[model samples]
Every structure is written in C-alpha cells, then in structure tokens.
Target: MPWSAMRRVIDVSGDGGNNSGPPVEQARGRSVAERIVINGLAIAKDHPPFAYAGPVPLEDYYREAVIGGPGAFVVPAEDFNQFASAVRRKMIREMAGLPSRPRMALAD
Candidate 1:
C-alpha cells in the first residue's frame, strides 16, 4: 500500500463462480479505474473432494471478466493441486511488470 510502489496489483483467486459480493466485471472495472491491476487464478474441479469440473470455463471467464489494465492476465490451475504453482507464476509475472502474451497457460 505504499504510494511509491511502482505497481499495484490485486490478485483474485477462486473457483469459476462469484456467488457473493460485487460481480467480477464490476470489481475488475473499478480496480482498473483506480489504477490497480487485477489478475485471476481459477481453480479447476475438485475431483478429489467433489469430483466435478467447474461450472464454467474459468480461464476464459477470468480473462474477459476478472482481469484488466495493462498486461493483466488470468492463470488457470488444472485443479486445487495446481493452485500453488499457478499463483507463483502469476506473482512472478505481475511483480516483473513484463508484457506477456495475451494468453498464458499455468499448468501442472
């Protein structure tokens, strides 16, 4: 939260739906308006715990709905097991502020 910080990013990680709070698009828009970058990490199906794919194409939804600003992106985790690695990749990209390809695949 430092004023001198070069980049401001708010990472939003979750499964495919937004069942609470403001809609994903609305939040992404607001954050972009505030000069903050928004990135998403979509968790795939809970095969181990629940055994079902996500209700939607999370990576696609995230790209269109949850991420914004210059070089913003969404990373897809194949499942909960891939969450940590996907997050790590996302953090590296965001912190570096590098201009990456329009789409990035964060796989296991």
Candidate 2:
C-alpha cells in the first residue's frame, strides 16, 4: 500500500490459533501500534474429520488474537457449508468500513 494512506488494514482469518507463531497478542499489539486495522473471519466446525473441530473454538481464538483496532470484528462460521456467505458478509463490512457490531455467526 502507499505510504500516504491514512490507515492500513490487514484482514486475517484462519481455522487455527497462534500455534507456532509468536503470541497472538504480540502481533496484534504491533499492528495496533502501526495504526493498522485487523479483522477476523474464523471458520469453525461443529464436528467431523476436519481439524477445525478441536478442543478450542476458532471463533474465540480469533476474537482474542486476530481482531484489533477501531471497529474490528470477528465473524464466525459455525458450519463449513456457510463459509462462503461468512466471507461475503465479512468482506462487505471490511470494504464498507462499517462500525463494529456484536459477533455474528452463520446458522445451519
């Protein structure tokens, strides 16, 4: 991005938490210091062979680790099938620069 831009935003979404990287809070803090906004869209699963269906919920992890800055949000996708719509809504909010809202999860 251009250096003249007012705000730099990085949207990060994943199925796992800070497993191998530095502590999530550290990265989030660094991004915040740089005046960069971070948002999260976590695709969590109810049950199955997928690794997402583990002990810790991905949504909670994202809310704690990946989301920061003003109006940041973490959209949760409880069902894998609804992942597309979750991404759509998240993208809309990010592109529109909408205000932060309560966490939203796509229903089955």
Candidate 3:
C-alpha cells in the first residue's frame, strides 16, 4: 500500500530541544501543512548532562513548537529509565487511534 494511504506520523523523540536544525516550529508548520501528524516523546530529566536550548518545561516546548497536525501531542518520560514504557504507551495510543491528551503515563 502507498504511504499516502496510511497515517503519516512523525515521532520526534529527543532528550533536548532542537539544538541543530531549522527552527522547530517552522518545521512543524511545514509538516502540519502537509497533513502529517507530529507527536513528541520528550525525555525530561532533572539534571540534564547537556544544556537545553529551549525554554523550561520541555513538554510545553514540545507541545507548542514540536507537535502539530490533528491530535498531535507530547508524552514525557522523566528519564531514559522510563523511555521504553513511554514509547510503548505512545505507540499503543497512536495505533489505537486514541484522541490526543497531554498526560504523563505513570509506570505500572
């Protein structure tokens, strides 16, 4: 099947904001314009080894500057320790076609 026949989703997973690239919001705008959904898996840490270029509240940065298109949203994982489950949950929701809701998934 052609890619156009399926949902076009870009999973933007990162430990920091867009450090080296075109402005994230501009890229998101371009993707949204193309009818592509952009979801974020932000690995927010209490003490990041590297400096984050964007504002505080990484999830908020993702929501505003990274995610776009219908039902686009962000899922935050506190650290790499939680990355696997966060990804699992994100994939489940996306595959299930669940409506977007900005909420952290507590580890089970």
| lDDT agreement with native, every candidate | 0.79, 0.80, 0.85
True-structure lDDT of candidate 1: 0.79
Give the per-residue lDDT of model 2 (tens digit) for 1-108.
456865678888677666786788998999998888999888776666766754567887787778899988998887778889999999898878844567899899
Which candidate tops TM-score? Answer: 3
lDDT of 1 by residue, 1-108 (tens): 456856688888987577679777887788899899888888767555654354557788788788899888888898888888998998887767754458877898
lDDT of 1 at 65: 81
Per-candidate TM equals: 0.75, 0.75, 0.80
Per-candidate Cα RMSD to the true structure, in Å, reads 9.4, 9.9, 9.0
- For 1-108, candidate 3 gives per-residue lDDT tens digits of 555445789999988877797898898899999999999999887674553546668888898789999988899998889999999989987888854568998999
Query: Which of the predicted structures, 2 or 3, would earn the higher TM-score when compared with the native?
Result: 3
As for lDDT, the candidate ahead, 1 or 2, is 2
